[model samples]
Target: MSDAAPLRIPLRPLARILHAREKGENPDAIERENLRLRHEEMRDRARVRAEGRILVLGAVFTLAFLTIGVKMWMVAESEPAEPRTSFAGAGIVAQRGDIVDRQGRVLATNLDTYALYAHPHQMVEPERAAEELVEIFPDLDQERLLKDFTGSRRFVWIRRKISPEQRQAVHDMGEPGLLFGPREMRLYPNGAIAAHVLGGAGYGEEGVAAAEIKGTAGVERAFDDYLTDPANGGKPLELSLDLTVQAAAEEVLYGGMRLMNAKGATSILMDAHTGEIISLVSLPDFDPNDRPNPPTEGHPDDSPLFNRAVQGVYELGSTLKIFAAAQALDLGIVGTDTMVDIRGPIRWGRHTIKDFHWYGKELSVADIIIKSSNIGTARLAEGIGINLQKQFLANLGLFEATPVELSEAPSGAPLIQKNWSELTTMTVSFGHGMSISPLHLAAAYATIANDGKRVRPTLLRQTGPQDGPQVISAAAARQSQRLLRQVVTEGTASFADIDFYSIAGKTGTADKPKPTGGYYNDKTISTFASMFPAHDPQYVLIVTLDEAVETSGDEPRRTAGWTAVPVAAELVTRIGPLLGLRPEIAPVPLADITLTSN
Candidate 1:
C-alpha cells in the first residue's frame, strides 16, 4: 500500500506543497529582496556623502574669500596718510606792519588775495579740464595745461596772487582738481612818487628787495633790518618823509628836468636840525609796482633806476668850497678876515688850478667861498695840509657813504686812498678829483646848518634827538654857514634864493670824466646844495643833474645855476609849507651875510 501511495502521492498534494512553499517564502527570493533593500540603503548613503562634499567645498571657498578681504583691509589701514595741500589749516599768513609818512599817510600796505593751484591726477578728463581752465585764464597755454595734467606730478601752480574776481571766476568753473591757496599781496598806492624809497615785494608777499622797504635806494634799503623783523612780522615804519613834501619835490624835479631837457636829476630835502630826509626825488623814477617795466630811455643817457642821491658819484666842483672854508676855519688856517692872493691861475707843478671868475687881487676867506674861487680853495687846502684836509673830509662823511638808513656806495673821495700828490690835493680842494654822492653833500650841509654836530641822516622819523659823533666845532660850523649864506645871496647860487626865506647854498659844475682818463671838455654834472632860512637854518636841500643839456636860450650850455639851482628853489618853495615851515619875515642882521666883490 505504501508504494502505490507514494507513486500516486497525489499530484494534487505535491502541487499544494509546492504552492505553500512559494507563498511562505523561498530562501532565494528572500535573499534577493534583502539585497535590493541593501542596495537602496547604499544608494541613499552615497547621495548623503555627495551632499556633504558639496557643503565642504562651499565652506572652503567662503573661508578663502574672507581671508583675502581681511588682508586687503589690513594693508589699507597700514598705509600712511597723505600730506595736506591747503594752507588754511596750516596757519594764518602773518600780516606785515604798515609804512607811514611823518604826516600819517600810508605808504605801503598788504592786501588779501588767493593763489590758484591744481592736482592733475584728480582731474577726470584732462583735455576738457584744460580747455575750461584756458577759458578762465586766457594767458594759460592749452597745450601746456594738457601736458601738466597728464604728467605724473600730483600738484602744480596755476597762478599766484589772483584778484578776487579772477579767483571767483576760476571757482565758478567747477573744476574738480582746482584748488585755492591763501596769500597776501603788497601794494604801493602812491605809484612812482616815492619809488626810490619804497622797494618792491616778492613772491608770497615776502620782503626781498630794498631791505624790507626801508630805503632800497634812498631810505628803504638803508633801514631794511629795522623795517623787517621776521620775529615781529614787522612794525610800522614811520618815515620823516612827508608825502605832500615828497610829491612837491617830485613835481619840481620832474618839471625842472622837462624844462631843461636834462638827462636825469635828483633832489633831496632834509631837516637841518635833525638830519631827517623830508623829501627826496630821483627823476625818471619807475613805479615800484611796475618794477618789471623797463627804465625810461634817451637823454643825457641817465639811468632812472640809479639813485643819484646815494649811488651816483661825481666831482662836486665849486660846492667843495663850502667844505674848504669850514676846514680852513676849523683848523685855524684862516678866518673871515684871512686873505689869499688870487691871480688868474695858480701853477702847482704841471697842473694849474684856475677860478671861473678871477678876482686878480687879494680876497678874504669869505670872498673865496662866495665867489667859489678854485684857486683860493686850493691855497686854503694846501695851508691846511693833506692829512688835516683828509681828516676833515672824512669827518664830514666824504670818505664813505652817508650813514643813513639806506644802502649806498661810499662817496668817491681820492683822499680815502691818500694819494695826495700836489695835483690830487689841488684838484680835490676844488672838487675836481674827489667825488661825493649828492646825499653826502646834503648831509655835510645839514651838519653846518645844525651847527657842526654831524647827525646821521635818517629817512625814519626820530622819536627823540638823534645821537651821533660830533665832527666839527660849533664856531667853525657858524662860520661855514655864514660863508654859504653869502654864496646864495650874491654868488653862484643866486637862483636858489627865495623871497619868503633867506636861502644859503653853493652851486657846482664839474666836467664828467672821460672813459680814457681826464675830464670831457663839454659834458658836465650840475649841482646845487642849499639850506633855507640861513640865519636859523631849518632845512637843507640838494639838487643834481647828470650831463644836463640846455634846450633854451642862445647859450645852450648847462650850468649849475641854470640846471640844478632852479630845481632846488622850486622844491624848497613847494615843500616848506607842507613841512610845517611857514613863510616868515626875513631877519635884518642875518641878511648881512651877502658876498661882496673886493
Candidate 2:
C-alpha cells in the first residue's frame, strides 16, 4: 500500500533561471511568471475545499427541512385526535387497593369499565341520539339530554359510569358523536353485605380517560390514603369481618327486628381478646353499590345511611349498671355478699332515681346487679364517689368514641353531663344521664370479657391479644362476669340463657326522649350486651333496637328482656358454629347410660 511521491519542482529553479537569463530578454520576467502561476494554483485548491464543505452543510439543512415539511403535511391531512393534557405534578391514581374479609373473600374491588360522553356538534341526529339514550337509562331525562345535545357546548357528560351492556346499546345506536372513556369503578360484589364496614367509593378528579376512586365512608374513608397508595402495589386491606358470620348475623337481626316491631336495629360482634370486630351490622342498611345521599331535613339518623352501630349514641339503660358495680368492687367499696340499703326513691336535688320494681329495703351487692336495682346501684356507686366514677368510665373508653376502624366513629362520642352533680351521678348509675353507642358498650363488655385488660375495638384482623392498660384487676372482672351470668340466669336477661352457649349478658331498656325535653312513655331503646361460652369467653355481641316492642305477650312490651335479648340469642345460635365455637354440652348422668371401651 505504498504510493509514489509527487515530483518537487521549485517555482524559480536555479537551472531554469540561469538558462532563461542566458537566452531571455529579461530575467525578472521569468521570475514574475512563476510566482503568478503559484498564486493561481493556491486559489484553485482553496475553491475546491470550500465547495466540498458547502455541499455537506447544504445536505444537512435540506434533510432537516424536508423532515419538518413532511411532519406538517401529515398532521394537517390526518384526522384530529383528542389532545392529552399532562400536568406538572403527580397524576390521579385510578387504582385502589381491594378490601377483603379476613378469609380473603373480596368485599370491595375495582372493575374495568367505561364512562359515556358526547360531542354534541359531531352528532348526525341530535334528537334521535337523545331519545335512544333516554331509553337506555330511564333515569336520564329526554328534555335535558336534548337540550345539552343541541346546545352550543362542544362536549357533554352522559354518564360517569356505564355497564358493558349499556355501552353496547349506545354503540349500536350508530351515533358517531357518542364515545366511551375507559374507567375503573369500585364494585361491591356481595351487594349490601358488609356495606357499612366497606363504606363506599366515589369519583374524584375525573378525566376523559380515567377517574379517581375515593372512599366516601366507613373503613374506606378511614383508610383512604392506605387504600389508594401506589406504593402498596394493590395489596388487599384485610378486615376482621367474617363474611359468613356477618351474613348470618344480618339475617337473624333483620328477622328479629321485624318480629319485635322495631323501627331500626344494630348489632356488633367483636373479638374479646384482640378487640377485632367480626361482624358489625346496622339494619335498614344500604348497599355500597348504590349508597344513598344523606338526608337534609328532620333527624338525619332516620335515614338508612346512618351507621347506628358506631354513630348512633343513646342511653344504654341498665346495660351500664355493670360498670357501676364493677368499679365499686374494684375500688374495694363493696363485695358480692355485702348488704346495702336500697330503700325508697333515691332523691337528689329535683331528680329521683327509682327502680323498675321494689326488691327490698336492702339487697346484696351481687343481687343489686342481678336484679338490676336502680336504687341499689345508685347506693353502690355513691360509695365510689364522682371523681372515681368519671375516671372508671374513662378507663373503660366510655367518655369518648370507640376507636373502631370506621370514619363515622368520631361522631359517636358518648354524651356525658357537663354539670355532673350528685343527681347526675345517681341517675347515670341507672344509665339515664348519659348516652353511648352500642360500640362503646361492646368495647366495655369486651374489656370485662377479656379479663379487664381494656380492649380498644378495631376492625382489622390481629394475630395476638391487644396490649391495653389494666383498667381493673382480673379478680374484679371475674366477679362482674359472674354477676352478668347471674343476670342471664335469674335476672332480666333470662331469655338469653342457652345451655349450650352459656351466655352471660345484661339488658338495657331506656325510654326514648322527646326533642322538646321530656321522655316518651311508649318508645324505648332496647339493648342486649352479651358474651358466649361464658366460662371462657371469646367474643362480645351487642344488639340494640330503636323503639322496639314485643307483642308476643298479653300486652305489648318494650324492654330489652323481651326484644333485644331474644335477638341476641338467635344470633348466637346461628353464628356460633360458624365462628368455630363448640357448644358446651352438659355431661350425661352416670346412671343414665353405660360406657363401652372401643
Give per-residue CA lDDT, model 2, range 491-534, as digits (tens): 99999897679999999999998878889999999999998778
**Per-residue lDDT for 497 in model 1?**
72
lDDT of 1: 0.76
What is candidate 1's lDDT per residue for 1-598, written digit by digit as tens? 7556333122234455577587894545544655677688779989999999999999999999999999999988895653332345443233456678997898987777777888888877788878987887899999998999899889878886688988888788787888887766667889898887775655532221111122334444554445455544456788888898888888888888888777788888888777788887877788876575435665323556666777777788888877878878887878898999777587766667787765878789988888888888888888877777777878877877676665544432223444667667767887877777888888888888888887667887877655556777889998888888888878878887787767888889999887568887878999988887888888888899888877678878678988888778877777777767778775679567887798
For every candidate, C-alpha RMSD to the true structure in Å: 16.8, 8.5
- The lDDT for every candidate, in the order shown, is 0.76, 0.91
lDDT of 1 at 67: 100
Q: Give the distance in Å from residue 491's predicted Cα in candidate 2 to where it truly belongs.
A: 1.0
- Reference-based TM-score, model 2: 0.88
Runs off by more than 4 Å, candidate 1:
1-93, 124-143, 204-234, 293-303, 408-418, 467-470, 515-517, 586-598
